[model samples]
Target: MPSIRLLVLACVIPLALGFKELKHVSYTQLPTSISSAGAELFQGIEKGTADAAAYDWVNHVLYVVGRTSHLMHVIDLTDPANPVRLFIHQFTRGEGFPNDIDICGGEIAVALSANREVNEGHVRFYHTYTRGSGATDVVLDGYVTVGPYPKSIRYTDDCQSVIVANEGIPGKDEFNTFVNPEGSVTIIHNERTGNPAVQTVDFRKYNTDDAAAWPYRVPSKYIPIRPTVAEGTEPEDVVVSSDGRTAWVTLLENDAIAEISITAQGLGLVNNAVRLPRKDWASKKVDTSDQDGGTHRRMYAGLKSLRQPGKIARLRIDNKDFLITADQGGVTSFTNAKHGFTWTDATTGKSLAANIDNPELKANANDVGYLGRLQVSSLEGKLFDGKNAELVMFGGRGISIWDSKNFVSPMFDSEGSIEEYTDSFFHDIFNCDYIASTATTKSPDTNKDTTSYRQGDFVSGLDVADDNGTVYMVVGMYGTGSLILYEVDTSAKVPIPMFQNIVRTGGVEDTWSTLYTNKKLGDLHISDLGIITSDQSPVDRPLLWVVGAGSGSVSIYNITESLPVIPGR
Candidate 1:
């Protein structure tokens, strides 16, 4: 029989051996410059700058998309410590706004939104490295027209095709009337060839009156003017299967996922759409009120949350594929005060209390420190119900992992871990909004108001890396500009995610007055993250690249095993 001391040692030794830490190694800022067309780029620095980034493992090059800047900045990461800004490629006025970018097979694909989001967009292709004599010269292979508001772009694992998600957001026309375009997924085949074939898949077949009977939630409120289910379905992000045979798109506003089958001829077939399960807060903890003084998490019965995922990534474990989502919720709200037209699917709890029939719920809604300040989706709930009203909120407030084969329920969910982690280590700035500042309208420190501390941690960017046989996941907190690392153990019957370490990459200052100018490793609003495995890294170790939209900076960190080796064998 094992002694008590030996049993204790066995448990303690594994805990100590599994320790890990993220060490900040290098940082660089995206430069703001005037385009050749004489247009000033990245002018609205406060609005955000860097939006997305992609890494080239072969050449050790990094490509960053400038959201407000309308430029693509290329940097050399040969030396992990000192990243060199190689050059910048400016997109002309006709190219539109670049939202996301992906690289494969020495080719780069960029998803660009039209000048008007409702109009048609384009996907421009370029060489990863400049072919021209000049270092700043960029060689454009060609461009293909895609659906409106192209938000995400990715290359298939085989590098034979590129998939794009066209958001197709509704907007007003010259007459100030709403024009809602049908959202779609565009597949470009033979991308490496000079001429590529394009095929766009739409949801017209699901626009019938019986659409309500469909499996997914087709909310009519998304497009009030034209409530067709096809136009209401917006694709936020897309991820392709490892074998490049299927693709999944996240319909954030609708709380659904659309699966499309990809053909070898570059065509896409809309197979099915499944609704994500809503989380019941009755058993889970959530901090619902921004008016609450500090991090006060509580379980509220009858309150449900939508897992409106903003980003999706595919991971293969034991020959099975799993989809991970960053449930950063969103609401459809449009206000044209001049035109006296205001439409929204969101409302404050205080305003909703008037329609609540339950006595206890009504009281909680009225109390400023409880649910009064929390914003919830009005599209749901029983506002019309004479007796009972259910509270439906946006976002899962964390991450969820769903089996690719089964979309009904998630295999694992980090329901309250994100909030608990932030509250435990960053209590001073718990649930802090990255954009909140004294100069902005959402300022929390203007009069020493602590409302911003209750906004909750917004998990935005996520990526997974495999070090040998061990799988690891990294999550980026947009609100606080922090990163959390978790080790995914697949040896169990069901995969288990163990929290390993959390690090604050952004400024630690409690106030926004000095947060952006404090010269931190990373800044606020982490828009995207990429991981370079030890095999692909120049330093022969794992590396994490984080892109900050608020501060327009790119930060890199080294993932090191913090466990000390035994003195002797």
Candidate 2:
């Protein structure tokens, strides 16, 4: 489980006592050594965009939570870029807008759902303190009801336990159509609860293995009824395992990663699945250019890509266990895209629905299993090998590593290096609103779609997180409104990174989000991440916080520690 080789000096190291050493380079792409301490230092709650953050190292107070209004803002970071908001927690009537929040010891926990309804979800809990109380009377000391869309929340450094990720999407109707549900994870022991002790878990026997009727059948005429292979599967992110009873969850539309243990005879699934990996895109390394022009976004070799990992981070390294994905690639609304399926161009073996104008793939087509959206563990004749057997698209824009024993082993993958480090640091305008999403932005005459667009630095990454508590940063959350940072692994031997910053917290200039802009501030597509550690952070280190559903704003980044200058030193 240790082979990865990309060579640029590769490996060599000797002369320790006489002092020659130096060789762990790391940085597969765009990172031009600029950490004038990585500027910005702090950018408080611009009114809304802050999705899930937590801190209170005793009373420094930070607890954010608001991706789209519904409120819960308590800043006062002792003053980091003018933070002092101090109070505002009116979720008013059974939660739903808050996406994630967590704080241990004094206890906080948030996570709500029902934005669309299927499990109607919930997870509230509070009590950060009340001895001297009064900030408008803070309430809700317990609430439990989870399943539908509960996004993220955690606590396990002995806070007694609490976790939630219940993504289970699939709730649509009113003629919009959709309903998958099955994704789960919701524990809450709270020292043996008397009134707050739920435990959901579910995975539908791990998605039935593989049923068939031409893609999970749903009024299928040719495929495209959206076969999520059943048990619906969705669950987005949850970490927890420094021995805290194990929990991993991250089933981003099933690229896979599941575990969930919580013992003493409670929770379940020690390995619901593991999967992950698909960036073969012929091996150009990756840049999945979808907007023609940026020179067709690289990824060479034989081409085929897929690395849809979103939000999942866990670390330990020397005691073994590791993981850090955020390949951020997702999409699914399937309900007859005009029913296409029945092609079979297994890379030219022929019959792409008679190749009329190309488009017959019937939703990804799981490696020839028909009905597809990625899950190819084998097959090559009908091409499924590294996926992209031909056409290409689907996340992995960068940030990966796993081997929590075997979450599909093999580590380090930031190939094409974060779109060549966002083409040397975003001057703005890249991925121009995601251009038809892949296969080199099209133009082979597949009818009218022409070509020549722009935005191609390749960001699809959705979420990933890390924080050793005091300082060991590793985050990647980018649906384009950036947040990249890396550098963790001082020892324990493997986890070598070197790009210290890529900040863009709020997606400016390319526009596309409006998210309850009551106070106005939007564009940080991030999804989730919240870090803390500080007497001041920066050179004192640790302070990451990101929040981006509608991007109302809350983008703090400061993880400096770059120093590398050895060559003839």
Candidate 3:
């Protein structure tokens, strides 16, 4: 509704107000001052950077999660002039690797990557604290294990419960090949000082292998034969409403999203004894027989199951009135009051026809869409845009958005086309182990055969600045030992990253990652490695902070002040 003004500053204010008075400075690349210092931080990381976490509760102590160290490296930012490593703690799990993470009320939860070799997955919780020596660290709190592998942990507003998306297998070897029951999602209720309350939710009632063929012809092998509920479904991401009363979990293995009721569980210190499910819970499962042949995991014959990039994603509320789902092919919006859930063309922005009894989301071929065009408005934030709610998602490949708004006939009808919409653009990429707003590393072409869909490095973690709606996405590119910064403006028409910075030690060409490169430019992607900053701030102007993960240092730059720092300066 309002226009964003980009302000640039000339003189640096006193160190105290420097972060506050700095104005937004636009640029194609990151500032040299910040980039140079960033690269130096990763000198000792052998395996490479895995994730990053920032503590704004106090000053700005940032924690870099790494695969090489297999530990969290803490950097103190009280001075902003110098960021020093405060602490490092290492730990390993059997089945899952550490991926995304979330921190609230002093507790931290990280998405555990599944190790197919072990067949177990889970999310680890910790009780974090600051030591008297000014070193910040975390003490491992009890963790909760779940189906196969949990890919992400999305926390409710109150941080009382966490919704985890279980991907079922470690992406390294087994990927989509494992034939277990569709992986299920779980809500872990965190008690203030005790272990978490875990609820295993199985919405895998529908299987893909039971579909019938037509026209006297056999079903094509290429068609996705849905796996059976007995085989498990994959749920990727869990999103919560602002009120923290509901959670929408996305099932990636099956094309569906589950609305779970959190209000029934209540907020604050949670009571662990509640079962919370009603009788209709059995009906929540959808039939995926058409997608998967009559037999689950049988279509692959002797080979392992390959993953098909499905066209379904959602942003909705649990046990609430609305849900918005977008498939790579189309978008679907459903209202709790009537019409069940309806499908739509994300590109064309029109509602499609659906038969709820035998629900097959039929979108006109002409209307098929991608993740870039869809968004959802909901009552799920500390701040609301009047009737225009939080646009829960900035479009991405195979991602979902969960908004708590009441569903109208056609989803987002009153919001107008996304092109005309004015909100800060948000760009999020999930790679490495964490989910970062920016893509950090470039995957090797040799590895493309196995990780074809993954063009870049992995994301280690992410966090949103509740005060200003700025999303801090951390991508840990293990291959190149770099961290990339991508910013999403909540008020932009489309997500456009204003800047990108690379974080690594020394020149990327001299790094060990370069020694293993098969082709040239493999290490060039991270030539400018380091920490990152964004312009979206509830504060007068926000200074994006970047701390080097490997070198154990920090870099701070006011996004507003560096716009005119001049190229090559």
Candidate 4:
């Protein structure tokens, strides 16, 4: 299999193509800062805002979503670097906030979260190609209802079904209380019009231990008392298995992932709850920040964080299944005295020892009152003893690989690699924190590493592509605003993924382009990544379509696939 995805490309090479690192080819920023294609359409737009994205290779069209703006901007990708926006459409619903969009088979679908206040969501379909009624672009089809706060929307590999990660985050009340709606994954079967079939898999049962962890949600003072809800798992994103029959959903708050099989009957009861591992600050070193008024380096024994994965991608190597995730672990900003002192709240009356007994109870003393704050006890089976443990912050800030089986076994991690890589080629200001082109920094802008490409940088999105014997991992760094490519060694029992090259999309001054309406496209927080296989792409090699939610821009890059990869992995 010499990169089966690209067949027609004639080539003669050695016995093996050992891609030690991903090759830096080229990239096209959506707006050249000088892009005046759609200046008349979107005027007064001056912020970094872009979120989920999907591509229609057949039409050479890219669909990017604006989560807060409730708009979907269409771009023609025939010209990779200088993409032209064909049109922009806003959601019809009064409160429709588009979360994710996917090119389902030939039909386009968009997931809409009506409003946080009203936990109602919907999935609307559209014909990829149509005509009449004086319309130049495609038209919307019918619509189907889904769960609340629907975040990640994806089509099964077969393209016959779709999965929506409905994160049931109950909007906070005036008093900062939450509703804690049951998180679920909605599967739309046979996406036909006559009878739309939808199944919502409630994750309450997977809580496993009845009393093991804190309730998914607790009541506020307004309630007579706090009631325990078993739905502790909140689904963030879903990635279908290699075969497309099984869907993997990430539980951000609970540090877990659920595997559910799809069939005509319904979503099989989740028999697998793979708990993510902890990024022990004890064993490994990480770059907390270069701006801590300290040396830019890795630290050890800092506290451990529940490897609460954000988005997950399923990968297959040598016929074995594996998973990768952007270890953007969720940590409460307002924790007990350890985080910071708070004299302005009611909970300040009690000390950690005198008042704190259950991790489910409010761990943050700022009595505006936060329920479901995680604690050390939850680490018993995963990390260590619950008593007197160190609480810390985490995000792995990179990527991690794990066996896709029920047991959580990590194979590798890219901690601090991206930050280290960015320091090598660009300015020092492009550290772990995202750099906006127009935004000046107070941190020392000197001392850049000029040798290594393997800088441990922060990643936001990932897309995978493979060839004969190599795996290519395309990573989007929200921190330094660059698209990174990597090669994974699939020969090992567990695949080993490593850094290769960094291609800045925009953001950095005088790097990707000189055109900066406000910020470079690199400054965009690359959120969604989708690959264009040779089957649909017109170019000589496959391509990648990436969108950043922050810059409200898109990047179309021609990719040479010879290695394995995945999006937001």
Candidate 5:
């Protein structure tokens, strides 16, 4: 065991200076056979390897699922310093790819998407504990068919039910026409029983005239050319309440959160979809261009961003429920250039600059030194009044904390702080591409460039860990391959997120090939994060497990705390 460091000034410090250190313990690279099978399918695309991870505290095991590999690699975590691979469970060819996983009450449930995105997917169940040394030790329990593209899954706190979020992304058919399935939520009751009752709740009820009057940005109303009312609203992730009576689903594209009522009668009712507030870049500074000289951040006059949260987690503070979201923005880019019905919700700042009438905003958008390469949404702030037009971007570019009671706006947002920290600390690789760019690559200073810093620290994964009431947040950046730790103070009226530390996990080396060849300690493109506390860990220390999709590796870290005090105090 490593020596534990204690903080001398525990109470006198301002708490903002109090930091948590993440010590890299060990890492294991998944077999190439598991990650290389479907490599040819997504040639130029940055595909995920170890997508999601679920820890079984009872067995001291970690189960990691590969998104494109179609396999689950199980590892024994009895020794935190040295992890051992136990076995691998391979899903059949047509069974589908595992998207997300969760463990509860000696049972493991995996959300799987079909071979085709438009087809119906399923939730497969298995035993978490291995009876023997073979792969068959993990017995197959059963499976329940779910909606299209089941993106995320979670087991209720009670372990009696399982909730799944069906994304229902649109896909082209044999005739090349788009087939959009209605997004839905699947709830499984008596999951441990032989015959489980399944209830798939859809958003069909909200497709009416009454729902049309809602305040949120409905995709159908904004685009009007693609999916209908129900089909346009896709559920990205689902988190359940402590009592298991309510579930909040993140509608990423719709810029809203759907509250669902879970009942004993096997019915999940869609109570309401509450729209989230947008972030005004005019007040919050953002790095709008990769062509700008070395992470240049400024407040744009007309730039606003939607908080299109990709993943969500619930945290309880002072007996009140707060929802934390990783606002990873997304855009719909389906186009048929031949049919002339080509419509995309996102466009470059240069394109919007050509259409808008604002002279100052137009000049900024036209100049590569400004916002020409930035990607903004075309759905909102398009005022054709010749005087003003607000440029609405796609994502919030940071994490947001929202009051669960009131979903109207966020209690606190790490606006520009994440970018500021990354730029100051990681200037050499600031805003570098996770897949394409190397660690030696630097953001262009003066010349007009687009690829290097186009996508700033794509905040993709986040998890909240509590160490004896001291709350900490671990934010995973997909673009730069970094992890940021923050000490969250929620006792006051509004929670204050204090910066602790930032560690670069993936981009320590020059290239992915060299990093992989050398068996690098950190991997790229962090897709998901899981935390095992001291009480839950077999090694009796808190462990942070990071799943890197770009490099096909799982990096483990041992967490410890330190308190820095003011000189007088």
Candidate 6:
């Protein structure tokens, strides 16, 4: 109303970048004695036996997969620590056993043979750069029946599409026990132009009430029963969502978590899903039959005991829309609340109240029976997506915090729990293998009441440290293999950190399954942490490259000192 009326001005922007500061400290012991200063290559020369669990760091070179020694080693970490092996490929089929390895562009995929006796080809692909040296050509392209094994494998950072976590069934068989159910996930849509288009998606077509058929039987050598497709849901791990469209498979027997949505007119089923029902899902089910009747006879089944499936991380809130999926044990977090993922319940830090059941929300089973396992600093979901958006979970018996805000129907609940760490016998295992280099974790008190956030243990292959968010988690203990460093709170809606240590050093036994780290070029490698990733690490770091499937040899280190002293996380 001021004469002429012409005045427009508006400004009000704050954004909110809080959370960042970490450095607790506890978990110690990463001294096979004390050696690795970083830098070594094919030391001994055997390169024969190696599990090499899971490692990936291309370009600068370093590709390994031994599964059972089907072999695949090519080291040359520019020099983050000194790894050298140039070449060594072997995959005559039958047990090449390579869990995970992806190298978009130059192409180099491997899931390898699988188990239960073996099934034709399983999954394999190579050409890392081809040429000569090894002559290359590990090809096989089409193969996957989904049985009692086929644990993990993921891609899509451009490497086309490859999500194989059949994980199959078998809670137990042989002579000790047997129940088996909930295990099936096959989403292979590879062919990012390279060729080999492979396409598949089957969890028994979605939900069959819980189908079965003698676990499918077939394989007395081939043809034990025939036309089958009815196995619970095992799905160990398979995440395809950096945008490549969509894919989050992870059933872990059956706690549940599927959100498929790729195009080309194919895999469009698996609609939205997120389960957490445990206590045996409810128990009661054990007909245990021989057949005769039909419906496969025998009935009653649903008791892998309470929660089991570990690892399943996916974050992308604030900006990337949203896409949470923590599923460590059964359901500490599960969100698609549109996009922003969700999870939290190490013990009960937060998020996860929808009704709270899955055995009280696990992780404190007396003190640490393993709630599940999680690792996701930021795949990009902004910072705490809707419906209470918030997550932070760690298992065996401690760590929990969920809030999830409430995206569309989001409501995880919880808010603060940390079972102290019940005695610490390792809690029950289930550390999910480990992966987290600092989402955020630091604060002696910093200020404001102190919300709490910190995590560690990306171990799988080891190699992370740009500024020292801190996380090295690769421990094969007893057998001797260490690398533990926590200090998180990089920014935290859930960074992870109760307190941890151990810090750098060599290993023994084989050092737990496989471990990998190439966050551009920091570098680290180990195996036996879960069982295999063989170890042909490559990183263009301070100079890091390793290869020792089992003493085959390859070493090099030169860090001297970085973080709290930098040992293990």
Candidate number achieving the greatest TM-score relative to the actual structure: 1
lDDT tens string, model 4, 1-569? 22321210111111235433233333433431222353533222224246787887667777777766666777776666567667666665564778888886678988888655336689888876422233456677778888877888888777778889888654543455545456778988778554767888776653433444532322111222222343335688888875667888887766677788877543545656666666665544444332234334544342445566786777787778888887765532222332122111111111232333434332331121111121222223223334323333435666777777744446666645555455445544445343345233311133222111122344668777664444667777764557776656566555665555566645333432232344443435567876666666756466777776655566666665354322220
Best by lDDT: 1
All models: lDDT?
A: 0.76, 0.50, 0.35, 0.56, 0.75, 0.34
lDDT of 1 by residue, 1-569 (tens): 12322332232123656677677888786655576686544433345468999998877888998766777888888788899878778877678999999998888889999877778999888878743335674578889999999999989998899999998887865676677788899999996677788999998878766745656666644544546788888899999998888999999988988899998888898998888998777876778876676668888777788888888988887778889999888877666742225677778777888888788888887887878887887777764454337777888888888888898788877767677666666666667664543533433223222432233676889998788877888999876777888777777544566666777765544345444444452556789998899888888888989988876888888888886322121
Lowest lDDT 10-residue stretch of candidate 2 = 21-30
TM-score of each: 0.90, 0.31, 0.48, 0.75, 0.88, 0.29
lDDT of 6 by residue, 308-404 (tens): 2244444442333222233233332223341133332223322232322334433221111121212211111112332212222221121111222
Judged by TM-score relative to the true structure, which candidate is superior, 3 or 4?
4
Query: What lDDT tens digits, residue by residue, belong to model 5 across residues 97-173?
Result: 89999999889999999988888999999988663545544778899999999999999998999999999887765
Candidate 6 error regions (>4 Å): 1-61, 64-107, 110-126, 130-163, 166-184, 187-201, 205-234, 238-394, 397-569
User: Which regions in candidate 4 have their CA more than 4 angstroms from the true location?
Assistant: 1-48, 93-95, 130-135, 172-178, 206-210, 213-231, 289-291, 333-387, 430-457, 467-470, 492-494, 507-519, 560-569
Model 5 root-mean-square deviation: 5.8
> Which candidate model has the greater TM-score, 2 or 4?
4
- Report the lDDT tens digits of candidate 3 across residue range 119-216: 55667777655646554457777777766666556677677888776665322234434233345567777556476567776643333444341101
Which has the higher TM-score value, candidate number 1 or candidate number 5?
A: 1
lDDT of 5 at 126: 92
Worst 10 residues of 1 by lDDT: 1-10
Instruction: For each candidate in turn, give its C-alpha RMSD to the true structure in angstroms.
Output: 5.3, 22.1, 15.7, 9.0, 5.8, 23.6
Each model's backbone clash number: 1, 21, 70, 37, 1, 159
Better of 3 and 5 by TM-score: 5
Error of 2 at 21 (Å): 20
Q: Which portions of model 1 show Cα errors greater than 4 Å?
A: 1-16, 35-45, 130-134, 174-176, 220-224, 337-340, 383-388, 435-437, 440-455, 510-513, 563-569
Better of 4 and 5 by TM-score: 5
